[model samples]
Target: MKILLLLLTVSVVMAQAQAPHIDSSYSDGQIQAFLKDGFERNDRLLQAKAYYLLAAREQNGGINNEYTITYLQKSHELFAASRDAYHLHRAKLALALSYVDQKTFDQAFDLQREALTYFEQRNDLFMATHAAASLANTYKLMGNLPQERVYLERCETNNKLLKDNILSLAILNSKVVNFQRQRQYDQALSAAHQLLTIARASKKTNFEIAGLFFEGILHQFKGQYQTAIGKLFDCLSLISNPNLSPEAMQCYLHLSQCYEALHDYPHAYQYSQRYGQASHAILNNQRQTALQRQTLRFDAEGKRRQIANLEKEKREAEQTALWQRTITIGIGIAAFVLFCALFSVLYFHRQKTRSDQIIENQKEEIKQKEINELRQELTLQNVQAIVTGQETERERIAKDLHDSLGGMLSTVRLRFDALKTGQPTHAYEQALDMLDNTIREVRHIAHNLQPDALLQFGLTAAINDLVNRTHSPATPDINFQTYGQEFALTPTQSLTIFRIIQELLYNAIKHAKASEILVQLNWQTPSLMILVEDDGVGYDTTQIQTGMGTKNIQTRVAYLNAHLEVQSVPDEGTTVVVTVGV
Candidate 1:
């Protein structure tokens, strides 16, 4: 716990030292599309901005990986080439921050200083304040508190000129950490109070929670256990879902310590148990997420290889045809020129040319036929994959029932028989527990196969049921909205669409790590549009060809001749839109 608290303080300091940027209105895919258009139009400024947006998207994804640095570098070069000094310096500041994240302090320090000077000279306090904050963060990481404080002061001065509460909030957060690190509880407490006031005024729940937690820690350090407990409780209450929040865990941990310090063993034990449960839940979630990612990666690799093979074959065939046509055309032109002076030879050449044209038409038809056949083969394969996946799922459920439930029932029967012959106390209770677990497993399997609401009510009811079942404290909040009137569809069509939405929601919850999800359905005459959007960690669509869930969705979409579009930006989120003829 001592080590945990020490690490917590350092992490809090680092986290609060940097200013948080607003989420981008556009997704990564949308930006990439814009970038492609810009390149085609030879718009250097647009290209530079797009590159910078990509860099910011990468930063929002929580790391300074190679892609982030490369994008920023590209953006910087383009801005310089376009002679856009304002944006060029902005790019330099971003690059400096990226370097800081990479822990390349030397480069970060130099670039940050240069950008800060530029912004200050131009009287751009907004950018200048950010530049100062970043430099301070770098210094903080390098363990130079005095120098860190100096730049932090610089940030405060610029922020005063700008009068931005968001900027002030960031500065105070770092101040709390700095003061606490220096063992100055009074100053730290003051900063914490200021942070709490600004956060509450802005209605930023997360920052408010952070401020309360900081105050609790400061109070605890000053040996005011009762006061600390109150502050921690307030922090815990502000969290919408305690079980799903790391903040809740922090509060529980500190509350337990505060109680223990006061020799209140019962409350301490209670909070300690809650903390343990929260920690275990978090760990399980992390493990499950890691397993899902590994599975997706394996699936994506296989699909990519298959697609590559198909493309290679197509390219080879096209190349062969191109060479054959080129050679024939060259020979035909040469023969025509050589025979132009002789009447009889010219007449023979015209007849041969007519025959050659017929042969070319035949070859073109054959090529078209082959292309059609190839497309048909691809379609058949996708259908087969979907069917095979369904069969696999059925087999898995059958195995679960046969092995797990069957074994449990046999054990229960034996236990009952032994009980009749006189067994140990609580034998009946144990048998009941086993029976209860078996019942729950049976219901779970049945629900996966087909929901009762789907059969009894319809698509809307089933979807509502799904949202209710899938949304939990451990998962993101899912909001289902419908625009226009509901439309009728056959049972099979409804089930297909339901499955597609189900897979999308699963991806958002298990894979995307989304905080919130919105599933909207728009019903129109003879058509329906489905949109699923999530504020989660998005991916570069160009790099990822497909996944198992994506394949499933694609199969269904093809069946209905629907149009599907997916747009995503790293850290910004993902939006999936599907339009189908009802």
Candidate 2:
């Protein structure tokens, strides 16, 4: 994580030095259609964001505003369904802002309230403050200052709670603009100063530019020409900071107004020309990109449809040719009359050979059937051995509980009965202690005999218990990783793998004396792969004869029609790989 941050910082600095701009091309209608299909085909999150942001840009451009709201709403629902609360709030806020633009104040207010609830519930004050400010702005637009003031105070309070002065500046700037609309110069000037102070500390040059703009407006209102001009141009210089295009253009237009106010006719004319040209070029580039994107999308869709129709036509032509060939095949059959007689005799002879082979296969199958039955018997016996051991253990615990604990507890209960209620002795307490321990031991034994947790949990928990019981506190590291998906094998498959793993582990613990062992099982498409590897003094492959254990391993694989590979050296290590068809 630390290394990634350092690398990201270096990349950002280098990219900034290059001043590379991302002029993205996108079709309005075609992008909408593609994104709609993207959700319909497989409603994934990145696709939802893809459509939502596309619609947002369209709304921002004042094109297809209604449809953009619909897309944004749909994207918000998708994000909510995916449980991405952050993005869900973002999309809802965008939709609300769009509604505000369309003068649907009631709907915008409701959406913003909902968005605020999401942010507030998660204690995300940054987003919460934004939502609050948006609500306040809606109230102001409706000419309700009392409600607007309440929401504005809330926004500021939340911003303070978050200690985000940048958000504070943004909110105050919004309020100053509202005050300016009411011709409240004193209030506007105060708010704008607060905004400027916070904005300078923000370190975001773009935002500081906004702060300076508001300050310049305040100064121009007061007829302070020189100071405002210097401050405005200082803000303008930051316009080429490699992250300022839209703001830069806006700043230039506002600066022309400032120049016009000072009655500098020539300077005003120059500033106005620059503003018009820059705005025109930006809009022109946006339109051309949109056109190119639309053309490419239409051409691609047309080509796809044409290819599909051609394929259908080709298939129909092939079918027609096939019917014609069928008619010609009748004539060819008659022409080969002499060859048919020789082919029949050869075919009959081959059929006889096949019949013999089938008989041989049936005999071999019966032999394999008997071997399978024998293998099943051996596997059952192994299971029975473990079960028998558990039964013996249970009997021993039951005896101790009944003979030792039960007798001692009975004696303790008699001692308690003999004691007066007001004159209980320390001996009575000792007897109580022994009685409690006895009861606990009995319960422990019962729990060990029948581990209810095994049924409640799963094979993993069961293995964990077995591992804790058999191994010491500190032993060789055990690595167990399940790949793909977890699954319960059929009884037969489970038994085979379990017994194989047990035998391998037993060898590692008792004979091989290995320090480390690794067992892995991976479930892949239509197959499963099991691998067991150990770093130990492995046996020589040539020296390994078909012992009882070796036969058991090979036979188990054979029964499952699985391929098993064993690789080992005299001293290095050993690895067992098994692949079974699902």
User: What lDDT does each candidate get?
Assistant: 0.78, 0.67
Model 2 has an lDDT value of 0.67
Winner by TM-score: 1
> What TM-score, over all chains together, does every model reach?
0.46, 0.37
**Which residue ranges in model 1 land beyond 4 Å of their true spot?**
1-24, 287-582
- Candidate 2, 1-582: lDDT as tens digits: 111111111121212211211123344444444444444445456455655756655653545455667668877887887888788777777787778778899998888999889889988776777777778877877888767778878877776677655556656766777677777777887887777677667676655766677666666677776767777777777676412266666666767777888788888888788778778778887799788767655654564454345446646766887899998897788768768887889999999999999999999999999999999888867655654564567657767776687667777767767773766578667767777777776755655544444555544454455445446645555666667874665645655555565556656666555788787778787788878778888888788777767776776776666899889986777888889885
Best candidate according to lDDT: 1
Local accuracy of candidate 1 as per-residue lDDT tens digits, 155-192: 77877777767667778888888888888899999999
True-structure RMSD for candidate 1? 35.2
Q: Looking at candidate 1, what is the lDDT of residue 505?
A: 93
Worst 10 residues of 1 by lDDT: 1-10
What is the lDDT for 255 in model 2?
A: 71
